[model samples]
Target: MQNNIKIILKIFIYQVIIYLNSILILDTFHEVRGYNITPQGYLSIIFCWISFLPLILLNNQKNPVMVFLWLIYITYIIPVSIIFPLINSASVYSIIFVCTINILFFSSILFFRIIDRITIPKLKIPWDLYKILIIGCGIIVLLFVISNPGLSLIPPNIFKVYSVRQHFKDNTPLLTMYIITNGGYVISPLLLLASLYIRGPIKYLLITISILISYLIYSSSGLKSIAFMNLAVIILYFYIKGTKSISNSVINIILYLFLTAGILYLIFDFYDPLIHWLRRVFFTPTLNTYYFYDYIYNNNSEFTTEAPQIVSQIYYGTSGSANTGFIGDGIARYGTLGLIINFFIFNILIFAMNLSSKKVPFELSTTLYLPFVYTISNSAITALLLTYGLLALSILLFLFPTKTNKIPL
Candidate 1:
């Protein structure tokens, strides 16, 4: 009971820090961009504060799924709430509506008791079949990489050649390659290998090599998020397996935060070439959200063009294009109504995944769920579906379903 109270208190403190961080980021944006916080912006911040209360009050901090959800909230939703309003002068009505949608989306988790009662057939794949599946995926990835020599195997060179947004623009070939190679073949096998790492010394050595190779592939593709996501998965796996303590996890998170801040400071101080690169990756989505509203409200134009096209217009004018974050995409594609619908649907999907994780083996569940958790902030519905679909396929092929008396970490 005392431990639970301590966990709850830690979570409460973390929530406070997240709230303060959101305010700090908003103030920094205002100072840099000279955007005034309107009444709607203030209302949005209020709503954000209110939305977080349910998570805290419900008190499931020790639950891994709940912990992951809270991590997502802190990492993405909090920053997004402030950043979006700072970039776009949304009306109070729209702000309130979006906030209400967010509240409903998160609050739906309280109803997971109903979801937990639904049962599906247990899947069971043999160990031999799992090995075969991993080997097959590795071969496929190798072939794909050989076929596409344009894909760099070095991080710096890849970043030099392609902007983050350019990777997702209307390049069907590159998109197809990503879906086939990275989404389909690479991530699942890497996760499986990572899961096997805790088995023994030889397995640990082999998995380390596999992880290094996977990191190179991901970094070479200029998607730093993939590398970070994999790292998070590995860390969470250790924690789940009881190989790492909560204190260690907290320490690692703090170290990562400090390292990220130090890197950002260096980039700012040195005026490195990467300053513009980082700006384009981080700020373009927020800027585009504002431009999207400008086009719709000020220009009195309908957003008939697809999200990529709209983002392109916002960033590169008439010719170039890029993908925006899920919220921006939702708003652009369907307006406030669309955004509300998307949020609700996304929330339901995540809720189902969370419940399903409890029913499966820890290794399989972690592999299947981590990608979705990491990518939810940045990916559109279509992109998310493709990635999850591929992951589901891998899960079906490699993971044996069993009724485990062991509780989820």
Candidate 2:
């Protein structure tokens, strides 16, 4: 009982430090990016902490999935919620709605303990068939990369990605696109992980081929997240191998990454890539949510399912997608009530993820699932499963061989 109290106290302290770090980042947003962020006095601070209580107080850290989602809330949602009304002429309702949805989101994670207790039956494929499946997937990825028009294997500049992405999308058939993406994103990474148990030149070959294919996929798709996924898998593999604590490692990495981004932005005198990335990742989605509520819903616009697209079209004069959060999409699609709708659908994914994490090594399953989480801030559930390979990845996780069932590679 005493030890439990100490752990809770430590997490609470870390939560306070994270909250302060968010304030510092928001101040940078106001100063560097010219966002008009001002606190609406102590009440806003108090309300923000109130919404944050579920995360700080609840011991949801054992699940890395929950920890990562909370990281998003800390970095993106909390800072924006507090400053929205002050900057964008946002109404009290917007603040209340975002806060309520966030509270529910964080609180729902507490039920993961209950959910994890429900055992998910695993059906393992025969080792021979599994080997064939892995080999077949690798062959398909190679064919796709070789046959694709852009064969440079050199990743496009981040600024030039849209054009490259459009070209790739226009040429690739939808089904083929998904298959190849799953092959690269899911199959190759799994192959890499499985190779760790192998003992021979074949293991090195698998690693080399996997790395090459991942680079080719990123180069072809112009998706930066692909590269990050590879990095995430490697980091998780070694970290879990050493520490065997996925949740704590993930939480610390997220906090440090955010802190480093904020500190770099504060100290740098000139523009740099990290600053651009920091703005894009940390600020854009939250600011876009502000625009969504203030500009779209406030104008009494018709409820449209294409909220992110519409926001992108109107504000940026581009037909591309906006960086709208799930709640923003909810508000723009179905008004305040849509938050509840979005929450249910979003939690279904969370529940599914929690279930999968229970069956496989948390590091393997969670890192493989990271791409889907990366898209949640901007993507609908349909897009996540269909467009982003969540369904395929989930199946792979369920089928993944456990250590006890290991077969020679």
Candidate 3:
């Protein structure tokens, strides 16, 4: 028992550390300063945390999933951190991204339970479904690619380019909030791969073609970064699937990422032959580390400030396009502890929800989807929605389910 307590504490501490690191690591911004504690950002995080108390008390048992997740989080991150031609953007943010996904998983759990009273189980799958899914992806992606303007080749820093929104007037930033350092296009592959478990090849192919076309025409142009990210996604997805143990998965992810990088270099030589050749010859760890470190420490125009208007200006197109959001501000306000606490609280809620036996409510699922994705995407809103949005209300309603008062959980 004593050992278990100690182990739990260790896991808890690890999560806390990771959270804070994520907050501070990525200091990118479109504004001269970071976003301030406006009614929206501040109130949201606070309410989100408070709403999560039930998660702490409810799921309530000592479980290893949290610890394993944290462990896997760190392991998956370290391998391909090298060869980054751009800023690493909060090292801790990656973990935050994963933890935020709890909103989705947790809410789903709640939905299952609530609807369990009247809903039927529906998870049957055909044996040949996965092959069809893959083919479908290829077809869809190819169509999307061919339909839209095809890039002759993927470019460097393709990883960081996000949001296809362009400005019509000079100095006009788009009025959107989701622009962040994304592994954007790379995730497309994982989306393709996910169809593996589902039914249909033509479906996956069609889907891929659609995405490819959308990307070429409507999507952002940068895609080189996605190459590395896509590789990471494949590794991370498998790791998350838990087919391999944490240690084994991490080893394979790193090796495979490097291997993929090599293959990409050789195949992509037709595009930017010079740089590709250069990276092959001299993309050393020392250089990679030095540049990443410089980005985090040396660049700080937007890391320290908390002016809401400034943030709003850029977010609404007054200043400039913010490549990175309030990451620097989050780190400054809470340091690494901030990121960990945020993620831990979110993860704790998700674990609680998933560990539960049935589907959560639909309202909860809807609320959870965007926030869950947002938090994982390194945004502040996900945590808020988890705590105070429709999901929380849905959970409350679920706990006291109706004239019959059935056992939801």
Candidate 4:
């Protein structure tokens, strides 16, 4: 009981620190950028903290999902709230709206936490089936590399040039190639976990093959998110396997910070690559969101179409890929209420799979679910449905098989 009280008190203090840090950072950034922090922005930031409190306080399970979600929130909010104002001063309304949307998103997860306790049954997968799944995924990954040689090993010079251009002339990959490459995203996390568990020459072979396949897929596509997702999986697997404690999770976060800082330093040295990458990762989505606001308020237009369409229509002459993230897309299409409704459904789906992971910790379900959670923050719903969507369905079918399909004892 005393230990429980100490844990609760520690978490409470941590929450306070996070809240204070967010406010101080926002204030400092606004002051430095010659902008005044609005009352609405302050309220929104506080509300954001409140929404996340349930997850922070009530999560006795020490699920890695909380860690990933916290990281995503910090990464997303710090940049948009603090750094983004330097580019352009967003209106108080826009800032508040974004904050509220985040609150809803967090709330959806909390709702799942409650339901997860009651609804999810314990799940188990046979060892033989798990190995077969990993090997089969490995074969498919190799096949992808062999079939799409041109797309698989992109030249560094070409990548550099493409990065500088900030737009690929023929960015639309073949349907077959796209599908095959996505297999890497789906299985890379599984391979990492499998490497940790499986023994002998087979283990080394799986690790080598996974690394090679991941390299080929990321090199061919030049999508930073996929690369980042792969890296996150490897890092997270070690973090989970090594120390399943809150303190260790903090250390893992610090390590991630350093890794991110190192990448940022490299990006600065190679500004052209950074520019192209940021154009897709940060600027385009943000610009689209801003344009979306203008379309509705300034132009007296209703947001009937998707956020990407709005971005494409307003900001022409780029790489025609106008995929704003889930936040932007959700708000643009359905308004705040719509975003809440969609997130509720999304939360349930993700949480169900997450429960399966907890039942049999650090196995196939966990491996499959990690990549999905890592990438879901930044991806559009439609894009995820197309890519990770197929992966999730496969995981459900295999990882959590029906009793009828269960292997005999």
Q: What is the C-alpha lDDT of each candidate?
A: 0.50, 0.65, 0.33, 0.52
TM-score per model over all chains: 0.68, 0.82, 0.36, 0.66
Q: Which one is best on TM-score?
A: 2
Mark the regions of model 3 whose C-alpha exceeds 4 Å error after superposition.
Answer: 1-4, 11-32, 35-119, 123-125, 157-220, 223-225, 237-318, 321-409
lDDT of candidate 2 over 10-120, digit per residue (tens)? 444444544454455566655543353664444445555555555554454555566557555655565455445434544667667657866776656655555757776
Candidate 2 global lDDT: 0.65
Residues 128-198 of candidate 1 have per-residue lDDT tens digits of 45445555555555455445444555555434635632553333265445644454334444544434523
Better of 1 and 3 by TM-score: 1
Candidate 3 lDDT trough over 10 residues, lowest sum: 174-183
RMSD of 3: 14.4
C-alpha positional error of residue 276 in candidate 3 after TM-score superposition, expressed in Å = 25
Model 4, position 69, has a per-residue lDDT of: 52
Q: Give the TM-score of candidate 4.
A: 0.66
Better of 3 and 4 by lDDT: 4
